[model samples]
Target: MKEFTFTITDPQGIHARPAGLLVKEAKKYAATLTILKGTKKGDLKKIFTVMGLGVKQGETVTVQAQGADEDAAAAAMEAFLKENF
Candidate 1:
């Protein structure tokens, strides 16, 4: 398993557009990906769950990836967050 925390930098937080894009990217990996906001957790491959977290700007969230290709998933997700949020 791989995990890390990343703070939201986008002024609008995740919203729908970015969340959809994230889900699209996440679907490429076989590993399971999840994001946590406080006590709320959501699957990265599901846009609705991600948006349901209600993550806001400046809030830090933990991302976890497990199973086959977890390392690659983690690396890609980290890069995506850095580049997008």
Candidate 2:
């Protein structure tokens, strides 16, 4: 498993649009992606699951990618967060 933590920088947090983009990005990989906030975890490929996370600005979001493409997926996810979050 490959994992990294990122603090949300978007003023609105992980709202609908970004959640949708995240889901889209996650779908491009076969890895199983999960985002953990405290004790809660949500599938990164699911819109509702991700949106329901209620991630807030400055909150640490831990992303874990597991599967064949985990390394690439994790890197892509990190870049995605940095570029858009």
Candidate 3:
């Protein structure tokens, strides 16, 4: 398993647009991707669960990938967050 933590920088937070994009990106990987905010966890491949978190600006979230391509998946998720969030 591989994981990384990121603090949201976007003023708008992880709203609908980015959440949809994030889910799309997550589907590209075979690994199981999960985003955790506090005690709440969401499947990265599912947009509703992600948006359900209501991740706001300045909040920290941890992303975990566990599967055959965990390394690449985790790296991609980190880069995606940095580039888009």
Candidate 4:
């Protein structure tokens, strides 16, 4: 498994558009990906699950991946957040 902690930088936070992008990225990986906020965690591949966390700008969230391509998944997700959000 691999994990990365990132702060949400987008002014709109992880709204529908960003959440949709996240889910799209997550779906490309064979690994299982999860996003964590506080005590809540949800599958990254599911748009609703990610949006349900109510992530806000400047808030910290953890991205985790498990399975064969965990490292690539984590790196891609981290890169996505850093570059896009």
Candidate 3, position 83, lDDT: 100
RMSD of 3: 0.4
For model 2, residues 1-85, the per-residue Cα lDDT tens digits are 9999999999999999988998999999999999999999989999999998899899999999999999999999999999999
Which residue pairs of candidate 3 clash? none
Candidate 3's C-alpha runs over 4 A off are none
Best prediction by TM-score: 3
> What's the lDDT of the predicted structure labeled candidate 2?
0.95
lDDT of candidate 3 over 1-85, digit per residue (tens):
8989999999999999999999999999999999999999989999999999999999999999999999999999999999998
Give lDDT tens digits, candidate 1, residues 29-76.
999999999999989999889999998999999999999999999999
Which candidate ranks first by lDDT, i.e. highest? 3
Better of 1 and 3 by TM-score: 3
| Backbone collisions counted per model | 0, 0, 0, 0
Q: Is candidate 2 or candidate 3 better by TM-score?
A: 3
| Regions more than 4 Å wrong, model 4 | none
